[model samples]
Target: MTVEYTDCITLSEETAELAEKELRENEATRRHGLQQVRDWIVKNPRIVHCRDDENFLLRFLRAKKFSAPMAEEALERYLLLRQSWAAAFNNMDCTLPNMKHLIDAGYLFAAPGRDKYGRRWIIARPGVFDPHKFTNEDMCRIHGLVYETLLEDSESQVRGFVHFADGAGVSFPHITLFTPKEAVRIVKNGERTLPMRHKQVYGINVHPSLKYVLDFGLSLISDKIRKRVKIYSSMEEASDEIDTNMLPKEYGGVIPMSEMIEKFKEELMAMRAKLLSHDEMKVRLEMFSEGARVGSVTALKQGSALTCGGRTLDTTLCGSFRKLEVD
Candidate 1:
């Protein structure tokens, strides 16, 4: 049975129509797309212990607009990155003390409902996490847990999602949490490696230092994503573009941010088994070399390098890294 978490809203009929029109998804396409990707995964030796369930595979297909080839590539990258960046991606235990704290504090979470465009909202209060108390990986894991769980919803896969960063209380200390390499890696993964489709990013009352970081991130992402980034002087100004009621009361909505946070924590715990199961979804990189066959095409050739998180690593050495490689 598919497990569900609270506060993660379901798809409306209007949104379902939008998904069919925008994502090219329907009953027919879903079946054909699922089969194509499933066949490729079974044939590909490098992919082991990965869940090939219909719900899981559909995320890639929906994100790629039912294109099997693109979905296959995304699936490969998703598993491969999780294998390489085990520290940040693995052992996603939400019950841990720090992880629980971040959840209770509302550091990052999915809003209770969809926006006017049908896209879900993931609000981030970076200031809630004391830079001194948590490491960059901790922040990454929290986001990874939330998004991974969110992506399980079929509507999120099709409608995609937006990010809202409440920059109130953000300061230089939060800015210091990430080194240059770390910052670049996070942006790269969010844009390139992850399987979900990212629609837009909204930030209100952003800190000057964090804006510098945001600027740096802009340089790393594609022009399409760059154009979707919207920063406002205040939440009121942001409401012009975003529906106010969809936002938390702190941001001029009817719902309280604390209420959403508590619900998100319950959602996280509800999906705990599924989240922890990711520890077993690893890639056997030996099967990814030059001669290996992924369906009809070669996965990678000898001496060919894989560019991950803006860093290039020789394909032969990709499996050796047990953690995100720091340069």
Candidate 2:
């Protein structure tokens, strides 16, 4: 017995029809709308090279409910945000040394089963969160793994993400590793960049000692997120909201965390090459195109450098799309 997610962010029949029409290019609106966005990106000197994949364009459109200009706004900000946090989001190397530590921590995983609405469940238990073992960059890198792999599905995007956050045994030490600044960055990225809908966030096993910390951290996020946040007072209360049968063994579920981790690892290994291919498509100063201007898109800004964690990132329009290396 569990509490059903009342507010699953679902794609309506009308939305499905619209997505089919616009994303598939079967209708005039898709062509006109996508072309307009492509034109905008080409004109903007800030945008170096644009990957105009029909599916990519369609994602931004679905994110904004098929509003062309709005999708453009979302896409532009997404690109800029990706550029700004390149250290946290770039180069596509998942075999890094820290990845093992991240996996061993066992803080986050995609549940093997889906909910009644077909929403993918992502569980994060910060009780095992060790800042000494991993930096925020590693967190973001693993987050990229989750983002680029698990939530990349169109059906899941349409159905939405069912988030479960367990704060049991999560003391001040665990929460502090994730700073307010980092919190804000994650919140902003989720709001502005990611093209997926958040169905609901179920907060379980939160003890009283950690209440203030949790509330304070949540305060830094948006009202949209706050509204979706449902803090359960106890395990029974949480079980009222979440299906225990679909959960891992630690949380009184059928599967084990170790099994889930193995499954995720296998999926990551299979996607390794495709992830590398994304390197060229993602925004980078090294891959910008100077002469690929299509229409009136001509607002080029001088190159700028950003330093984060002692690493400097430079961004400028180079020449054009370089050959994508897909291994």
Top candidate on lDDT is: 1
* Global Cα lDDT for candidate 2: 0.63
Q: TM-score of every model?
A: 0.81, 0.73
- Scanning candidate 1 in windows of ten residues, the lowest lDDT window is 290-299
Which pairs of residues clash in candidate 1, taking residues 3 or more apart in a chain or in different chains?
290-301
Q: How far is candidate 1 from the true structure (C-alpha RMSD, Å)?
A: 7.3
Best by TM-score: 1
Which clashing pairs does model 2 show? 3-240, 3-241, 43-297, 43-298, 45-299, 289-319, 289-320, 290-319
Give the per-residue lDDT digits (tens) of candidate 2, residues 38-74.
Answer: 7766755455666676556656776666666667656
Model 1 misplacement above 4 A: 1-13, 286-327
